[model samples]
Target: MNQFVRIQYVFIVALFAVVVAVSGCRSSTKTYSPEDVVHYDESYDASDKKKIVRDLVDPLVQDTFPLARQTEKPILVVYGISNRTSEHISTDGITDDIRMELLKSGKYSFVNETQRANIEKELNYQYSGNVDPSTRLQKAKQLGAEYMLTGTLRSIEKKQPRQVRLQKKTLKYYSLNIELTNIETSLIEWADKVEIVRESSKPFIGW
Candidate 1:
Protein backbone atom coordinates (compact mmCIF):
# COMPACT_ATOMS: atom_id res chain seq x y z
CA MET A 1 0.00 0.00 0.00
CA ASN A 2 2.80 2.38 0.95
CA GLN A 3 4.65 1.58 -2.29
CA PHE A 4 1.53 2.33 -4.33
CA VAL A 5 0.99 5.60 -2.41
CA ARG A 6 4.62 6.66 -3.07
CA ILE A 7 4.25 5.95 -6.79
CA GLN A 8 1.06 8.04 -6.92
CA TYR A 9 2.77 10.99 -5.18
CA VAL A 10 5.76 10.90 -7.56
CA PHE A 11 3.46 10.74 -10.59
CA ILE A 12 1.41 13.70 -9.36
CA VAL A 13 4.57 15.83 -8.81
CA ALA A 14 5.95 14.92 -12.22
CA LEU A 15 2.66 15.86 -13.90
CA PHE A 16 2.57 19.19 -12.06
CA ALA A 17 6.17 19.95 -13.09
CA VAL A 18 5.36 19.13 -16.69
CA VAL A 19 2.37 21.47 -16.67
CA VAL A 20 4.44 24.29 -15.15
CA ALA A 21 7.23 23.78 -17.71
CA VAL A 22 4.78 23.86 -20.65
CA SER A 23 3.08 27.02 -19.39
CA GLY A 24 6.46 28.74 -18.85
CA CYS A 25 7.48 27.97 -22.45
CA ARG A 26 4.49 29.82 -23.92
CA SER A 27 5.52 32.90 -26.00
CA SER A 28 4.21 34.99 -28.93
CA THR A 29 5.88 37.12 -31.59
CA LYS A 30 4.39 40.18 -33.23
CA THR A 31 5.19 42.13 -36.42
CA TYR A 32 4.34 45.74 -36.97
CA SER A 33 2.81 47.03 -40.22
CA PRO A 34 3.92 50.34 -41.69
CA GLU A 35 1.48 53.20 -41.60
CA ASP A 36 -0.56 53.78 -44.75
CA VAL A 37 -0.12 57.55 -44.54
CA VAL A 38 2.82 59.73 -45.54
CA HIS A 39 4.25 62.53 -43.49
CA TYR A 40 6.90 65.27 -43.73
CA ASP A 41 6.88 68.41 -45.85
CA GLU A 42 10.29 68.39 -47.53
CA SER A 43 12.16 65.28 -48.61
CA TYR A 44 14.32 64.48 -51.62
CA ASP A 45 14.37 60.89 -52.79
CA ALA A 46 18.03 59.97 -53.40
CA SER A 47 17.20 56.94 -55.52
CA ASP A 48 15.11 58.99 -57.90
CA LYS A 49 17.90 61.49 -58.28
CA LYS A 50 20.42 58.77 -59.11
CA LYS A 51 18.17 57.21 -61.72
CA ILE A 52 17.48 60.54 -63.39
CA VAL A 53 21.14 61.50 -63.55
CA ARG A 54 22.15 58.19 -65.09
CA ASP A 55 19.31 58.05 -67.58
CA LEU A 56 19.16 61.67 -68.69
CA VAL A 57 22.39 63.56 -68.06
CA ASP A 58 25.00 60.97 -69.05
CA PRO A 59 23.78 60.36 -72.59
CA LEU A 60 23.39 64.06 -73.27
CA VAL A 61 26.95 64.79 -72.20
CA GLN A 62 28.35 61.84 -74.16
CA ASP A 63 26.65 63.00 -77.32
CA THR A 64 27.94 66.54 -76.89
CA PHE A 65 31.54 65.45 -76.33
CA PRO A 66 31.57 63.29 -79.48
CA LEU A 67 30.20 66.19 -81.52
CA ALA A 68 32.99 68.46 -80.31
CA ARG A 69 35.70 66.24 -81.85
CA GLN A 70 37.07 65.46 -78.42
CA THR A 71 37.34 61.82 -79.34
CA GLU A 72 40.53 61.19 -77.42
CA LYS A 73 40.46 59.40 -74.04
CA PRO A 74 39.85 62.58 -72.08
CA ILE A 75 40.56 62.57 -68.37
CA LEU A 76 37.60 63.91 -66.43
CA VAL A 77 37.99 66.77 -63.97
CA VAL A 78 34.97 67.27 -61.72
CA TYR A 79 34.80 71.03 -61.23
CA GLY A 80 31.87 71.75 -58.92
CA ILE A 81 28.15 71.28 -58.36
CA SER A 82 26.75 74.05 -56.21
CA ASN A 83 23.64 73.23 -54.20
CA ARG A 84 21.63 76.44 -54.03
CA THR A 85 18.92 75.02 -51.84
CA SER A 86 17.81 75.00 -48.22
CA GLU A 87 18.24 71.30 -47.65
CA HIS A 88 21.55 69.52 -47.23
CA ILE A 89 21.85 67.60 -50.47
CA SER A 90 24.66 65.35 -51.64
CA THR A 91 25.36 66.57 -55.16
CA ASP A 92 28.41 64.34 -55.23
CA GLY A 93 26.26 61.20 -55.22
CA ILE A 94 24.46 62.38 -58.33
CA THR A 95 27.73 63.31 -60.01
CA ASP A 96 29.27 59.96 -59.11
CA ASP A 97 26.34 58.11 -60.66
CA ILE A 98 26.83 60.08 -63.85
CA ARG A 99 30.55 59.44 -63.77
CA MET A 100 30.10 55.68 -63.44
CA GLU A 101 27.76 55.65 -66.40
CA LEU A 102 30.25 57.66 -68.40
CA LEU A 103 33.01 55.20 -67.56
CA LYS A 104 30.89 52.21 -68.58
CA SER A 105 30.20 53.86 -71.91
CA GLY A 106 34.01 53.67 -72.52
CA LYS A 107 34.06 57.10 -74.10
CA TYR A 108 36.21 58.78 -71.44
CA SER A 109 38.41 58.36 -68.38
CA PHE A 110 38.16 60.10 -64.99
CA VAL A 111 40.83 61.69 -62.83
CA ASN A 112 39.46 61.13 -59.35
CA GLU A 113 40.30 63.78 -56.78
CA THR A 114 42.55 61.47 -54.78
CA GLN A 115 44.43 60.25 -57.82
CA ARG A 116 44.97 63.80 -59.04
CA ALA A 117 46.21 64.88 -55.62
CA ASN A 118 48.69 62.01 -55.41
CA ILE A 119 49.96 62.72 -58.92
CA GLU A 120 50.44 66.37 -58.09
CA LYS A 121 52.31 65.50 -54.89
CA GLU A 122 54.67 63.11 -56.66
CA LEU A 123 55.33 65.63 -59.42
CA ASN A 124 56.17 68.30 -56.88
CA TYR A 125 58.48 65.94 -55.01
CA GLN A 126 60.29 64.98 -58.20
CA TYR A 127 60.76 68.59 -59.27
CA SER A 128 62.12 69.49 -55.81
CA GLY A 129 64.97 66.98 -56.26
CA ASN A 130 67.78 66.79 -58.83
CA VAL A 131 65.38 66.12 -61.71
CA ASP A 132 65.89 68.30 -64.78
CA PRO A 133 63.39 71.17 -65.20
CA SER A 134 62.45 70.15 -68.74
CA THR A 135 61.69 66.61 -67.57
CA ARG A 136 59.23 67.96 -64.97
CA LEU A 137 57.36 69.99 -67.58
CA GLN A 138 57.26 66.99 -69.91
CA LYS A 139 55.72 64.80 -67.24
CA ALA A 140 53.18 67.48 -66.45
CA LYS A 141 52.21 67.73 -70.08
CA GLN A 142 51.88 64.00 -70.31
CA LEU A 143 49.42 63.88 -67.38
CA GLY A 144 47.52 67.03 -68.29
CA ALA A 145 43.78 66.44 -68.65
CA GLU A 146 41.94 67.40 -71.79
CA TYR A 147 38.69 68.66 -70.35
CA MET A 148 36.69 69.48 -67.20
CA LEU A 149 33.05 68.79 -66.37
CA THR A 150 31.01 70.91 -63.94
CA GLY A 151 27.43 71.55 -62.99
CA THR A 152 25.08 73.02 -60.40
CA LEU A 153 21.89 71.95 -58.63
CA ARG A 154 19.20 74.41 -57.70
CA SER A 155 15.86 74.02 -55.96
CA ILE A 156 12.68 76.06 -55.81
CA GLU A 157 9.92 75.24 -53.36
CA LYS A 158 6.33 76.42 -53.32
CA LYS A 159 3.77 75.47 -50.69
CA GLN A 160 0.02 76.01 -50.93
CA PRO A 161 -2.90 75.16 -48.65
CA ARG A 162 -5.86 73.28 -50.01
CA GLN A 163 -9.16 75.05 -50.36
CA VAL A 164 -11.50 72.35 -49.06
CA ARG A 165 -9.60 70.83 -46.15
CA LEU A 166 -6.83 71.39 -43.64
CA GLN A 167 -4.16 70.04 -45.91
CA LYS A 168 -1.14 71.57 -47.60
CA LYS A 169 0.73 70.67 -50.78
CA THR A 170 4.42 71.22 -51.41
CA LEU A 171 6.10 71.37 -54.79
CA LYS A 172 9.82 70.88 -55.11
CA TYR A 173 11.52 71.83 -58.37
CA TYR A 174 15.12 70.83 -58.98
CA SER A 175 17.29 72.11 -61.81
CA LEU A 176 20.51 70.37 -62.75
CA ASN A 177 22.98 72.04 -65.07
CA ILE A 178 26.06 70.43 -66.59
CA GLU A 179 28.95 71.80 -68.67
CA LEU A 180 31.95 70.36 -70.44
CA THR A 181 34.93 72.68 -70.84
CA ASN A 182 38.00 72.12 -72.96
CA ILE A 183 41.07 72.45 -70.79
CA GLU A 184 43.43 73.19 -73.70
CA THR A 185 41.26 75.84 -75.35
CA SER A 186 39.45 77.16 -72.22
CA LEU A 187 36.17 76.83 -74.11
CA ILE A 188 32.88 75.35 -73.01
CA GLU A 189 32.33 72.62 -75.56
CA TRP A 190 28.91 71.50 -74.34
CA ALA A 191 26.25 72.49 -71.84
CA ASP A 192 22.81 71.23 -70.84
CA LYS A 193 20.19 71.54 -68.12
CA VAL A 194 17.55 69.15 -66.75
CA GLU A 195 14.72 69.86 -64.37
CA ILE A 196 12.51 67.57 -62.25
CA VAL A 197 9.73 68.23 -59.82
CA ARG A 198 8.10 66.22 -56.98
CA GLU A 199 5.04 67.01 -54.92
CA SER A 200 3.81 65.84 -51.52
CA SER A 201 0.59 66.36 -49.64
CA LYS A 202 0.46 66.90 -45.89
CA PRO A 203 -2.65 66.07 -43.89
CA PHE A 204 -3.50 67.54 -40.51
CA ILE A 205 -3.36 64.37 -38.43
CA GLY A 206 -3.65 65.17 -34.74
CA TRP A 207 -0.31 64.02 -33.43
Candidate 2:
Protein backbone atom coordinates (compact mmCIF):
# COMPACT_ATOMS: atom_id res chain seq x y z
CA MET A 1 0.00 0.00 0.00
CA ASN A 2 2.81 2.47 0.96
CA GLN A 3 4.74 1.85 -2.32
CA PHE A 4 1.63 2.43 -4.45
CA VAL A 5 0.90 5.76 -2.69
CA ARG A 6 4.51 7.01 -3.29
CA ILE A 7 4.36 6.07 -6.99
CA GLN A 8 1.04 7.92 -7.48
CA TYR A 9 2.45 11.11 -5.84
CA VAL A 10 5.55 11.04 -8.14
CA PHE A 11 3.36 10.63 -11.28
CA ILE A 12 1.19 13.65 -10.37
CA VAL A 13 4.29 15.84 -9.68
CA ALA A 14 5.82 14.96 -13.09
CA LEU A 15 2.58 15.79 -14.92
CA PHE A 16 2.34 19.18 -13.21
CA ALA A 17 5.99 20.03 -14.13
CA VAL A 18 5.38 19.16 -17.81
CA VAL A 19 2.25 21.34 -17.95
CA VAL A 20 4.11 24.35 -16.48
CA ALA A 21 7.02 23.94 -18.91
CA VAL A 22 4.71 23.83 -21.94
CA SER A 23 2.86 26.92 -20.81
CA GLY A 24 6.09 28.87 -20.34
CA CYS A 25 7.33 27.89 -23.79
CA ARG A 26 4.15 29.17 -25.40
CA SER A 27 4.39 32.48 -23.56
CA SER A 28 8.00 33.00 -24.71
CA THR A 29 7.08 32.96 -28.41
CA LYS A 30 7.54 36.34 -30.13
CA THR A 31 4.24 38.02 -31.06
CA TYR A 32 5.23 40.88 -33.38
CA SER A 33 5.27 40.38 -37.17
CA PRO A 34 8.40 41.35 -39.12
CA GLU A 35 6.46 43.87 -41.18
CA ASP A 36 5.65 45.84 -38.06
CA VAL A 37 9.34 46.69 -37.68
CA VAL A 38 10.69 49.83 -39.34
CA HIS A 39 14.30 49.92 -40.51
CA TYR A 40 15.40 53.01 -42.48
CA ASP A 41 18.37 55.21 -41.74
CA GLU A 42 17.95 58.95 -42.24
CA SER A 43 20.06 60.29 -45.11
CA TYR A 44 20.35 63.85 -43.87
CA ASP A 45 22.82 64.80 -41.17
CA ALA A 46 22.77 68.18 -39.39
CA SER A 47 26.46 68.80 -40.00
CA ASP A 48 26.61 67.22 -43.44
CA LYS A 49 24.26 69.68 -45.16
CA LYS A 50 26.11 72.64 -43.74
CA LYS A 51 29.46 71.22 -44.77
CA ILE A 52 28.27 70.37 -48.26
CA VAL A 53 26.84 73.82 -48.93
CA ARG A 54 29.84 75.63 -47.52
CA ASP A 55 32.31 73.57 -49.49
CA LEU A 56 30.43 74.13 -52.74
CA VAL A 57 29.25 77.73 -52.44
CA ASP A 58 31.91 79.59 -50.50
CA PRO A 59 34.68 79.61 -53.10
CA LEU A 60 32.31 80.55 -55.89
CA VAL A 61 30.86 83.46 -53.93
CA GLN A 62 34.30 84.71 -52.92
CA ASP A 63 35.47 84.66 -56.55
CA THR A 64 32.37 86.52 -57.65
CA PHE A 65 32.33 89.20 -54.95
CA PRO A 66 35.26 91.23 -56.34
CA LEU A 67 33.21 92.11 -59.40
CA ALA A 68 30.53 93.80 -57.27
CA ARG A 69 32.70 95.55 -54.67
CA GLN A 70 31.40 98.96 -55.64
CA THR A 71 28.18 98.34 -53.75
CA GLU A 72 28.32 98.98 -50.00
CA LYS A 73 27.66 95.24 -49.49
CA PRO A 74 26.14 92.88 -52.04
CA ILE A 75 22.90 91.72 -50.42
CA LEU A 76 21.64 88.31 -51.60
CA VAL A 77 17.96 87.57 -51.16
CA VAL A 78 16.19 84.22 -51.25
CA TYR A 79 13.46 84.45 -53.85
CA GLY A 80 11.70 81.11 -53.12
CA ILE A 81 12.05 77.38 -53.66
CA SER A 82 9.78 75.23 -55.81
CA ASN A 83 8.98 71.65 -54.79
CA ARG A 84 8.84 69.44 -57.87
CA THR A 85 8.38 66.22 -55.90
CA SER A 86 5.30 64.24 -54.83
CA GLU A 87 6.20 64.42 -51.18
CA HIS A 88 5.12 67.37 -49.03
CA ILE A 89 8.55 68.80 -48.31
CA SER A 90 9.25 72.07 -46.55
CA THR A 91 11.45 74.20 -48.83
CA ASP A 92 12.09 76.64 -46.04
CA GLY A 93 14.08 74.05 -44.08
CA ILE A 94 16.54 73.41 -46.89
CA THR A 95 16.86 77.08 -47.83
CA ASP A 96 17.39 78.02 -44.23
CA ASP A 97 20.12 75.39 -43.95
CA ILE A 98 21.91 76.77 -46.98
CA ARG A 99 21.44 80.34 -45.81
CA MET A 100 23.07 79.52 -42.48
CA GLU A 101 26.01 77.90 -44.24
CA LEU A 102 26.53 80.90 -46.55
CA LEU A 103 26.22 83.33 -43.68
CA LYS A 104 28.88 81.49 -41.73
CA SER A 105 31.25 81.79 -44.71
CA GLY A 106 30.96 85.60 -44.46
CA LYS A 107 31.53 86.00 -48.21
CA TYR A 108 28.03 87.41 -48.83
CA SER A 109 25.38 89.31 -46.88
CA PHE A 110 21.73 88.25 -47.25
CA VAL A 111 18.61 90.37 -46.90
CA ASN A 112 15.92 88.65 -44.85
CA GLU A 113 12.52 88.45 -46.55
CA THR A 114 10.74 89.91 -43.53
CA GLN A 115 13.02 92.96 -43.46
CA ARG A 116 12.58 93.44 -47.21
CA ALA A 117 8.81 93.30 -46.85
CA ASN A 118 8.85 95.83 -44.06
CA ILE A 119 11.02 98.19 -46.09
CA GLU A 120 8.72 97.85 -49.04
CA LYS A 121 5.69 98.67 -46.95
CA GLU A 122 7.37 101.73 -45.40
CA LEU A 123 8.49 103.01 -48.81
CA ASN A 124 5.01 102.64 -50.29
CA TYR A 125 3.49 104.42 -47.30
CA GLN A 126 5.88 107.39 -47.41
CA TYR A 127 5.67 107.75 -51.21
CA SER A 128 1.91 107.32 -51.48
CA GLY A 129 0.34 110.30 -53.35
CA ASN A 130 3.58 112.24 -53.14
CA VAL A 131 4.55 113.93 -56.40
CA ASP A 132 8.23 114.19 -55.48
CA PRO A 133 10.05 112.04 -58.10
CA SER A 134 13.37 112.19 -56.25
CA THR A 135 11.90 110.61 -53.11
CA ARG A 136 10.46 107.69 -55.06
CA LEU A 137 13.71 107.10 -56.90
CA GLN A 138 15.69 107.22 -53.64
CA LYS A 139 13.38 104.68 -52.04
CA ALA A 140 13.75 102.36 -55.02
CA LYS A 141 17.50 102.63 -54.87
CA GLN A 142 17.53 101.92 -51.16
CA LEU A 143 15.51 98.73 -51.66
CA GLY A 144 17.55 97.34 -54.55
CA ALA A 145 18.58 93.70 -54.10
CA GLU A 146 21.74 92.52 -55.84
CA TYR A 147 21.33 88.75 -56.10
CA MET A 148 18.65 86.06 -55.83
CA LEU A 149 18.86 82.41 -54.74
CA THR A 150 16.31 79.83 -55.86
CA GLY A 151 16.07 76.06 -55.93
CA THR A 152 13.91 72.94 -56.30
CA LEU A 153 13.64 69.52 -54.66
CA ARG A 154 12.91 66.43 -56.73
CA SER A 155 12.34 62.78 -55.70
CA ILE A 156 12.09 59.35 -57.29
CA GLU A 157 10.92 56.09 -55.72
CA LYS A 158 11.29 52.46 -56.77
CA LYS A 159 9.84 49.28 -55.30
CA GLN A 160 10.53 45.57 -55.71
CA PRO A 161 8.05 42.94 -54.50
CA ARG A 162 9.03 39.35 -53.88
CA GLN A 163 5.83 37.35 -54.10
CA VAL A 164 7.33 34.03 -53.08
CA ARG A 165 8.88 35.44 -49.91
CA LEU A 166 6.16 38.00 -49.28
CA GLN A 167 8.65 40.81 -48.93
CA LYS A 168 9.06 44.27 -50.43
CA LYS A 169 12.05 46.54 -50.90
CA THR A 170 11.80 50.29 -51.59
CA LEU A 171 14.35 52.82 -52.76
CA LYS A 172 14.03 56.58 -52.58
CA TYR A 173 16.10 59.17 -54.39
CA TYR A 174 16.22 62.87 -53.48
CA SER A 175 17.83 65.75 -55.32
CA LEU A 176 18.40 69.32 -54.28
CA ASN A 177 18.79 71.75 -57.19
CA ILE A 178 20.11 75.22 -56.38
CA GLU A 179 20.94 78.25 -58.51
CA LEU A 180 22.29 81.70 -57.73
CA THR A 181 21.05 84.38 -60.11
CA ASN A 182 22.08 87.98 -60.61
CA ILE A 183 18.88 89.97 -60.17
CA GLU A 184 20.03 92.84 -62.41
CA THR A 185 21.00 90.67 -65.39
CA SER A 186 18.64 87.72 -64.85
CA LEU A 187 21.62 85.42 -65.33
CA ILE A 188 22.44 82.32 -63.33
CA GLU A 189 25.88 82.73 -61.79
CA TRP A 190 26.09 79.31 -60.15
CA ALA A 191 24.11 76.07 -60.23
CA ASP A 192 24.61 72.89 -58.20
CA LYS A 193 22.67 69.70 -57.54
CA VAL A 194 23.05 67.39 -54.53
CA GLU A 195 21.65 63.89 -54.61
CA ILE A 196 20.81 61.51 -51.74
CA VAL A 197 19.37 58.01 -51.81
CA ARG A 198 17.95 55.55 -49.25
CA GLU A 199 16.70 51.97 -49.45
CA SER A 200 14.67 49.71 -47.10
CA SER A 201 13.27 46.19 -47.05
CA LYS A 202 10.49 44.64 -44.90
CA PRO A 203 9.28 41.05 -44.63
CA PHE A 204 5.60 40.12 -44.25
CA ILE A 205 5.15 37.05 -42.09
CA GLY A 206 1.35 37.00 -41.95
CA TRP A 207 -1.08 36.58 -44.87
Top-lDDT structure, candidate number: 1
Q: lDDT of all predictions, in order shown? A: 0.72, 0.68
| Backbone collision tally, model 1 | 0
**Which window of 10 residues has the lowest lDDT sum in candidate 2?**
34-43
Can you give the TM-score per candidate against the true fold? 0.63, 0.59
Predicted structure 2, TM vs. truth? 0.59
- State how far residue 63 of model 1 sits from its true place (Å): 6.2
Write candidate 2's Cα lDDT for 1-207 as tens digits.
Answer: 699999999999999889877774334554554335332443344433454455456555565556334345567888767888777666776678677776776666788885778888777876786656566635546555688989887778887754676666778777778888899999987787878677867776631
Residue 66 lDDT, candidate 2, scale 0-100: 62
